[model samples]
Target: MAGHKIPHFQNDAGHSAIEIGVKEFMCVGANPPFDHPHEFLDMGAETEKVCPYCSTLYKFNPALAETETVPAGCTLTTEAA
Candidate 1:
């Protein structure tokens, strides 16, 4: 993201996955006191989305098991990892 101050959701592997069914979400660079304008993000068939306002990139992973945010390859989200 531009300026690198833009905040994004990330797993322990530094790769973040958007959960299924939660297609629409809000993108804010920071919280409360330092928050930017709330940008609405739509996760379509594409795997990645970027917020125009904050330049934050949001990724959708089909392998997230429908109930998780982290990818299947993520160690932090699985027991067998």
Candidate 2:
């Protein structure tokens, strides 16, 4: 997992819950400039998890791509090293 490109998402739209494909990902409260600390979340054996930083709930969706989100615009294109 050293070179894995972990999917990162942001909730700029302030959605109460977001549907994502990947069970493991990073939740950035909002887009940079207003974003909270990027928190890595994993939903192992579960369908959903909540971000403690933003209190945003994330639901797993098998129908979506690993880098996709239900409402869209939640996937962060640019990532930091």
Candidate 3:
């Protein structure tokens, strides 16, 4: 009896799978969409500071004592914290 050699399989699905894995494994941290700020600034608001990178709002209180400069273009308004 003689053994037959099988050829390697090639398909678009395999290429797509490899591409997706590479993209997912890539270190694309803080690249886009979820832009993380390097420095946090306190706007002196009642208890919240707006993130400049992602434009997401954050809150700080007197208990934490975490003071940071508020980003530019943000208004400081005092409220009960």
C-alpha RMSD by candidate, in order: 11.3, 1.9, 25.1
Q: Supply every candidate's count of residue pairs whose N, Cα or C atoms clash at under 3 angstroms.
A: 0, 0, 5
Global CA lDDT computed for model 1: 0.46
TM agreement with the true structure for every prediction: 0.46, 0.88, 0.28
lDDT of 2 by residue, 1-81 (tens): 345678899999899999999888898889768799778888999999999999889999999998889898799853542
Error of 1 at 4 (Å): 32
Stretches of model 3 off by over 4 angstroms after superposition: 1-37, 65-81
Which portions of model 2 miss their true places by more than 4 Å? 78-81
**Candidate 3, position 50, lDDT:** 41
Better TM-score candidate (2, 3): 2
**Distance (Å) between predicted and true CA of 32, model 1?**
3.0
Candidate 1 local lDDT, residue 7: 24
How far out, in Å, is residue 68 in model 1? 5.2
lDDT of 3 by residue, 1-81 (tens): 125221111121111111010000111113335333343243343444443444444443333221221222122222221
